[model samples]
Target: MYLKDVPRTDPNIDPATLLQLARDVLETEAEAIRQLAPRLGEPFVQACRLLLACRGRVVVLGMGKSGHVGGKIAATLASTGTPAFFVHPGEAGHGDLGMITPQDVVLALSNSGETSEILLILPMIRRLGVSLIAVTGDPASTLARESDVNLDASVEREACPLGLAPTASTTATLALGDALAVALLHTRGFSRDDFSRSHPGGKLGRRLLLHVADVMVKGERMPTVGHAASLAEALLEITRKGLGMTAVVDADGRAVGVFTDGDLRRVLEKVDNVRTVGIAEVMTQGGVRIGPDLLAAEAAQLMERRRINALLVEDSDGRLVGALNMHTLLDAGVI
Candidate 1:
């Protein structure tokens, strides 16, 4: 496994120097991507516009390392509001070209702008009359010249010591792909819910889709006591419901405030006869409340932000319908 022109590392090079060499590679690649920033101008916008207007999918094509990047770019585009998929140029020559159509847009990647396999497919793509967008290092090469839009993903130098490996250039192309995907996402107003729909098996989907109603203890399971109830009565309800808190409702069975273990502790410190105190006198009035339809993650966020452990769920009529806590959220995997 020898690469031409690559230097053999001196075994004498200390561990510190070896680590520094690795760090330099990362820094060089970062700078290369930084240099790519100014090169993104009208061409990038034109590429996005073409993809946006396409009635069919964005067909990404590349060879070698560029193919790997193209696959990831296609996945990102497809998941982020753009319809796209990658087709290997080698496979395309072997009849996979049928996957593309004139209604689609072709995204071709080649660092040298002269990948033979990609070059081989140019005629078939043109024959189909689909617009071509080239992401390449060479702006004046054959691929660029033939493209309807040429995005300059050129880098000043490769991070490889021999300046041969597809290091910096590949990173820049991936960043450019991400930029395009995010831009399209913004224009299409893609939301967390939409992303959740595409990735329902992931935690992000559960966070966005799980609502308070789905995780809350509703109906008779909810812990409640009248505001006029004594501290002993409120404690009985809280202990019975195992929520560490009980809603203090009014005569209409609508919640007005909440009494928690924390409040009970405070009341005990101030009053010797805790049983004499009414929940209305000690309960927190109109405690931070949420609707049943509120996202469970939002509920968790509110409880986290307010440094509380539980949330009281209320209906449109302001009646206490349910309750949830950190435990409930964790049990439902919404945290």
Candidate 2:
């Protein structure tokens, strides 16, 4: 390639300086995390054991940026089968401490290991006989020294060029908190069902989590027609129920074929007098359907892939006990 075709570097930029700065920042942060991995000795295991055994919630406390990380950690703990909540250190001194019980375990965070608000509540926490676990950079600092168990979250320096912003330190603290939550989760044998219980509003909770029985249509709302009925009768049933389709059933109330709006359109194109034809003659044999026991999410996938608007819900004997449409899934928020 010609020199003119090559991209020109900025005149003022020094590539070596930029690369060195990036390396230093990553090295410092990596060193902090590397230190934490081995520190998962008996103390860390004991901490997980304690939290797992606790009958009450885990109370987290921190100041400023640490507080934000603490909130996220608490949420992670709660969603992973551990009951926990973040208590602002400043607010804890002003009556929010009432939320904590003697049965609870307190996880306090402070980079300097000397947050006044956290220290202010130490005496009260002690009086309540609550277990105190501290996460701080200094092991010998007041908060760390006074805590029942201190987790060392020290870092060499901040990733910031000024060495003032809490970049690498906060990152290490958050990673440590995540490690603790996950370790406790595994120890407790927390399952996906448990997680879904804590997060019923999320998408994952709706998929593998929510049961089919919770969102299925039942009783008179279902559109159904006898298998021997005329095509006109099935169409009237579909129109009356407003489900765009009707379940064709046998004499024993079992599902046979399904007559949908699409079937009607195709049949109408072939024969102008579809009203006189028997529904079984024009209905789709072995149409796509679902059991009431199946997940609503699975039903939605089936409908989408098959390009169908409704499904005949059948029992083990192919009995048409219920019916569902795309609208049903939409209304239930299963889609």
Candidate 3:
């Protein structure tokens, strides 16, 4: 597609000017985020403590652009160990307020703290005896006045030339929300394992964590054959298990060689009678293997680097205990 086809910018605008406009906006908002660091005082600490001590879910509410930021903050909190959800101010009055209980905390966001929808729900929230927290540019607004705690998401000015669009203010509010979530995360001593549990489908959950034992084939599903078995016997085990390979084990049940479908084709070229050949004679010795305790993602990396599929899962004693293949990785969402 041609650059002129893009809808956001004027077709005749200079590319450098467009880039500079975006850069300026980002720089101004970045400065706004930086300024929020020193402003974290007693109120911020108390907000973190309240969120940490919350027994019920965090119900975030706002209108317009503040609602968008509130939704994002709720998602971040929910994914990072804090149970939370967004409650649109308009919807809360239309029966969605049933989702909130007295044990829950309501975090309301409004730049002027006078957003009609959010202000309208203040009475219902108070009547439910729910704890109230407000994020606003104005501390004197009704939302802040009625809140149990107030978070100042105020900014000096917006990056927009019109000074109407939410730019610096939204950035500051987002940064403050992140600070609260992170502080609560630290105070709760949330670990990477806990984070992974919450994000099992994400890339971060796959890389630094998730173990092979959590995804590998085991017991009767694993393909194995005695070291003295014929190539045909090994092939039968591979076909029966459908892992594309069979682990050959010694008399002591230790892995000695692995016979894959690739090995079968290669051996067929060299052996006059493949059916009579011993698997040990045709198999690759000391093939790439992994421990069941290893990460499934690490196994994928190893297989990719070595240009192979299927790994014999060995115990610490080198005894074959399990087996896994590319299909297993795919099934476990490790691919």
lDDT of 1 by residue, 196-273 (tens): 777777677789788899899988888999868998899899999998888889899888998888888888888887
Worst 10 residues of 2 by lDDT: 1-10
* Local distance difference test, each candidate: 0.89, 0.84, 0.85
Q: Which lDDT tens digits does candidate 3 get at residues 119-181?
A: 887888889988888988988988889998898878877888768899899889988888888
User: How far in Å is the alpha carbon of 35 misplaced in model 3?
Assistant: 1.5
lDDT of 2 by residue, 65-98 (tens): 9999999999999889889999998998999999
Off by over 4 Å in 2: 1-39, 202-210, 265-272, 304-309, 315-318
| TM-score of every candidate relative to the true structure | 0.88, 0.78, 0.77
Clashes per candidate, residues 3 or more apart or on different chains: 0, 0, 0
Choose 1 or 2, whichever is better by lDDT.
Answer: 1
Candidate 2 has a TM-score of 0.78
lDDT accuracy of residue 182 in candidate 3: 89
* Ranking of predictions according to lDDT: 1, 3, 2
Q: Which of 2 and 3 is the better model by lDDT?
A: 3
Model 1, CA-based lDDT: 0.89
The order by descending TM-score is: 1, 2, 3
**Pairs with backbone N, CA or C atoms under 3 Å apart (clashes), candidate 3:** none
* Highest-scoring model, lDDT: 1
